[model samples]
Target: MTHLDDTESDDIGTLLGADGPFARELPNFAPRLAQQAMARAVQQAIAGRDTLIAEAGTGTGKTFAYLVPALLSGERVIISTGTKTLQDQLYFRDLPKVRSVLGARLKTALLKGRANYLCLYRLDQTVREGATFERTQAAQLATIRAWSARTRRGDRMELAEVPEESPLWPRVTSTPENCLGVECPFFEDCHVVKARREALEADVVVVNHHLLFADLALKQEGFGEILPGAAAFILDEAHQIPELAGQFFSQSISARQLTDMAKDVLTECTGITGAIGLLLEPVEALQDALRKLRLALEPLPTRGAFQLLEDRADVRASLHELRELLATLEELLASQAERSRGFANLRERAELFTERLERIVESHGDQDVRWYETFPRGFALYATPLDLAVPMRGLRERTHAAWIHTSATLSVAGNFDHFARQLGLDDPRTLSLGSPFDYARQGLCYLPPDLPDPNARDYTEQVIESVLPVLHASNGRAFLLFTSHRALRRAAELLQDKVPWPLFVQGTAPRPRLLEEFRASGHGVLLGAASFWEGVDVVGEALSVVVIDKLPFAAPDDPVLMARLAALEQSGINPFMGWQVPSAVIALKQGAGRLIRDVHDRGVLVLCDPRLTSKGYGRLFLASLPPMPRTRALADVQVFFANALSPDARDGGEGRAGV
Candidate 1:
């Protein structure tokens, strides 16, 4: 048996030497600050005493840093991430290399959420239902079905070119609402179960924030936990945890549930014998009541939990009406010609909706925090908080393990308190690792001295004017990140006709396609919203300038932000300092992070929001960026760009100190 203990005293540098497997396996690999962080992190994990929040800067080689320690510690570890791309990256690319180099002494597993795995039973049901499948999707389904026959690894990411919103995806995936679990026909061969079993057996389990938060929520109700008793729980991309945790912590039921019930009634209205319409009478009544509920809530903010009908009389009356009607429908369907045929679907849907509504009504009031969601040209719902902090704290307390939460933008102005307070972590060991890149020589921070206030009319026009020059200097190898989609659209309109380069906007093509076109078309200037702020990798000269329209503060009118800030204010906290500013700081960092992804990458981060140089709060945003050459003068920016592209760009004459 492989001994489960601390790694033998060995220099990590030696392990990373020229003759070592790491050298042979990864050509561009070398010792990183992350390696040292990992050694300390591993020792802390073993000690099991305190939480560690270590910031491994961009290109600090953080993934391998944590992975090496997690592997060498010889204990069960669960690594969670914010994105599926990184999750798959760790599982498929990084994990294998680590195992091979370490002589395969450790076992690891990649576990995705249920939605990513195909539910054989559901797939079969969908096929039986004769749902006319799209041609390409049908082909992909056939491929997945064939591959499912012999494959042991059940990751959906293995299937290439499967767009996230493919219609076939929903038909094949599982949700807790529809999952029959062990009672399903294909339960024995369930991909989710198989993956979970592997996870339970492995020394390390890789998961994303959604899955981890789900497991935490599940444990509250005595549902199964995903990660076993592990020595450490390392949450990467920890910046995203709070928002996701808020979601898992909240409860929601949508008007769509009632709509689906009405559709079910319609489906069962025909082809059945006795009293089909009568049986569906209560369902129809329930649908009408739900419509009334939606109308009653029409006056409220489009999103957030609010009590539209105070005193529970209207809602209780509706529930009573629904319950009585459902009973009649059940009795009518019981006497139908085909007893079980054509009846089960509607019955199941009705029963589920009723149960969810009952839960909502029963849990309403201040005891359970309540809210309503309004979507623009989309579905809306009413929701309540399902105790977010409890589960999160449970995960923290039970693990009794040294947990490390790291991100490039974790702290705002050298203070980790904002995220720490939200996550219920107190004074965790923290460090701010400056980016290792030579930012002074490679990058410029351009804050336009004169611009209209970000909130004023013609703000976007001014932003475009300020940034268009930088784009010209770089010949349009730029990413323009806007605070809102409306502004993005406005800026795109302003630049489309005037700019002397190919401009790609976010919604014009899908995000990946836009990024592709931007990278390929050398005159690349891509304008995008939130998705473009972070996780966009455009190394080298292909992305030479990132123009941010403004400091990316959460919209004051956003329901969640308003609600959260209100809650903070009620508790006697400065909402701006406690919530808004820190959030914006993190977001600004994400936008600025796009500027220099590699050592060879040289660029300017031009903020059209003069707040970075004008406002007192600007210092917070400024301090959060890489230690780069800052500039405000138009002349300085022009000179810097000229020097950057000149033959002597690398020779580095001190262009301008602080602009």
Candidate 2:
């Protein structure tokens, strides 16, 4: 095997294109110009050590496009993905395949957020306390205990019997907040520390956006920094970076935080045997304060930003009481600093949490927005940045490396201005690689006319009515995607008795299982929210009709979005054009890209929102889509699917006969 020199890097075409090793190494490899082009661009970025943002359309083999270049560059690189699912795929499948193809001796490590790993300290504490559990959870914990005795990685994903959303997970895992760090008796055997050690020393590391932010924000637990040492960075699914970075930069404190801290202090006192008796009094007082705060805010609406919640007499009083109690707790914990190291760490965390809550409640940052997210159990107060550019600019300056942000949906109307501006990257070398799918021959963009505006009260019902016929034509191999829970529930209610196929909703099961069941059901109609729009791939005839209830827009009432929009308005910016439209366009592109996933696949994309046709901004959404044949008539959509469901599509024969 020969090491490719700088001159040989130009042969990226031969490597990715047909008649190259890809053809011989991969049985089903179909070369696309977009993939080859993107790979070369990535190679160039690494060679020059400059920032680049590339949008490779679907079927571009983007994982290889970036992975191949990064691996070949022989640089200490970190590739971050949007989700853990993709993270695993890159580590376990794509990276290995590409490395094998390159004959590269790459040292790779996969690191997830700390929450994914089991904390032996937490697990032992729970087990020793004889914590009560439901029968199923008890059995699950028993299985975990049995596995814990032998497992090396200690990743919760190894427990295939336990679902990812199981309530038992949080009990076993450690969050950054509750983590005892080096104070734990099991510190030497900690899995998170082990994983981070591997990532810190490896040639290539695969991480998720959350972990990347931890590195970029310099808040990672368990070890040394990961960002400054890496020679290059590649972010797959880069569209998720802005929102994820926003979360990391923001500060939040919640009733749950207080409860967790109190519980941890008490558990420490109880679990550590004859140590730290003085901490319990303040811990108990802290618990009482938390309860008082919860009771005070119980009467108010479940959620609102500080603007709405701060003025209420009961909430204000509760805030004052909680702040005073937290202060007292901090002082007490500080006094115990000399007695126990754990107490010292607790005091520092308490101080941080207290400071964070004050900042959130007071709206401390100049460009920050104060908001709240409500829940049935409790609510959280947040101080979120209105824009991530300032913080992102700081990260860019701190790290001198080639930063590549690549995704299939990073651009709107063939432009990267929205994404670049959000991330404070001015004049990055940008490229847009078109999809290889012949959308003109394989797909149809169905826009039904005379539908009500998406905001109207009758919108969900109208959408259901409009798509019922399309479902019939395709024999119910459809994905019904909604933008809101209210809309999803309404559509599910109306279509319950009408649709012939089995109906599947998002929350009914784990995401992977739902997709699996939907696929196995063959004609199942799965209705879901934003999660359903992206990261879903259903090839062949199982998914032939994609029905979008409305133009994909973030909720206007959402705390973060609302605050950002207001901030933009204050700055004399057109919030709608500058922020809202581009966001919606990117989301709509994700929803639309769900169809026609494979070369031979065929489907009809149903846009149920009338605003998509009536409003002027709709043109931007259309321009972002793969240029498929458009139709305004319902009969045309029905006919398109009718012809698609024929033997033509399955036989790999000519399609687009009806359209």
Candidate 3:
């Protein structure tokens, strides 16, 4: 119901112009045509209540592009990002700067999922059972209790003393199934309730994709309809939506859910007489069944269709036993449901798990794929729909709000059809704004010649050999992104004592710590896998080269991917060209984007996959990237780096071929 006046519409362009408020207030701000154009398009989309698909390349200042229009729109806005880290960045860093520069009067709030908040009721329960925890965990619990008395927001991120992966987190946090809602003794002062209440009243709310999709999928995360009634929904890093939508729509059951239910039942028994004797046998039986099933699945592939269970008689037997034991636990809990609210919740969880297991086991429809994935000591089963377009479109229509999807890599070969079809949009408003950064002058694309095929047995070794020269030329300030962990590990082993610069390897430390140390190590070579492909920003001379080991195609053995490809083929679509290629192209765009983050950033991108040259589809990948000059010879790369670091080069002199 909010509309922009003529002056306000003009102000979007003027405010983001060279003499805008940002240019005056911020020291590093520079105006770009692409950013202004994107702002106008977003403004129009919000005013007209239309869907807009925007692809703003890196350095386009897409965040500001959307934020300016959103803040100026004079309506309730919800901005959902790709990750929690980004959600924090927007809420803590970006929003404040823009709000200050514009002097906007809108109220804003940061809302995360229930797991991010501390559950006071659950914390009290854990305190009562402190004797059962290890010495370190008990100490961690004491720390959390002390912090709980003084922390205002109660966000777990506020407590850096406790590591994120600490087991104590689950003991203190409440999931939707365990939360008693208004029935809890601490409902009046609950943090999740307070956060949601603030979001309901704020003019703008910042959330991650998981919370946004959880609302759309109607998944119970303690609160209800936290995102509804917003006039605009701006999805940043929108390229991650299609795949994430599938995850939200899927019906899943996991070993952790079952184990947690058993643990909760035992915790509940502490308050009720005779409850322990009644539930002890069934709880132990269910735990044993879960362990047996995991052991049975250990012999199969880590992930595959549910049909894999049919071929293994032992696995089938174990699954059947697990299901039966779950039913017994549910029935026993039902008898004690009348005793307490906690018992009633436990009964419902047991019943839900039993029904989910039955549905997953019985699912044989062609429209959905029933798949199972195994971890080191756990497993999860899912029945995921083949297409998310119908449900996603339905959700959008129901919202009756403007939808703006923007990211750096939403298009393939200058086309948006692949991304649009995934989201079920039909010729929606489209805008493609290239990055204002001078890619041609600031970067070089080096496809190393004489490299073996990516599928060859010695491909990893060859890739390490090929990138060593590039590393030497750049002084090893590089990120070597691989398609899989096996290759990353191999590269790390090969580069260990062979290079003069320090090496940073994934899995050795937390992602944030690794990035921090890598940035400090001026000449460090970091080896990483999928997680490093996107949402990573490293600007300046610290990161000068990015070497991709292979084309980032989804593994063919993935159960959901295999099913989706088959469905596409049945619909007369070229699964390889239409689905796989476009997906890989978007992924490659993200990988290549790391090389040039700022206007002054100059680096070489080395793609070690020979398939990019040997195959016809290579053209699509090449055309989608930034317009960096391409080279096939190693000498060009050497010269590009040598001249790039020279003082003369810094003073506008050039020795590189493309330059």
Q: Taking the tens digit of each residue's C-alpha lDDT, what string does model 3 give over 264-368? A: 999899979999999999999999999999999987899999899988999999999998999999999999999998999888898888998999998888878
Candidate 1's C-alpha runs over 4 A off are 1-25, 133-154, 219-225, 257-279, 284-300, 308-368, 376-378, 382-391, 645-659
lDDT tens digits, residue span 482-507, model 2: 99988998888998999779999988
Ranking by TM-score: 3, 2, 1
Alpha-carbon TM-score of each model against the true structure: 0.87, 0.94, 0.97
Tell me the spans in candidate 3 whose CA falls farther than 4 Å from its real position. Answer: 1-9, 646-659
Per-residue lDDT of model 1, residues 1-659, tens digit only? 12224454245444654565677777677655545545555455455555877666687767776777677777888899888888988888988887887776887888878888877876676666665667897787788788667666656766766777776776678766556656567889888888888888889999888888777755421125556587788889899888888777666667665565456455546555544546555666767766665555556566554454444566446546655665565555445524544455445555555565566556645435555565542344445353345556776887677787877778887778888877888667776666677787888888887898888999998888888777777778899999899999888888878888888888877777888888888778889899889878887667888888888888766555666677778889989987888999988888889888866777888888877778888888888888887778877777776766453553363232222
Candidate 2 deviant stretches above 4 angstroms: 1-9, 222-224, 271-281, 299-302, 338-341, 363-365, 645-659
For model 1 the local lDDT of residue 224 reads: 57
Clashes of each: 9, 0, 0
Q: Which ten residues in a row have the lowest lDDT in candidate 3?
A: 650-659
Cα-based lDDT for every prediction:
0.72, 0.83, 0.90
lDDT for position 544 in model 3: 88
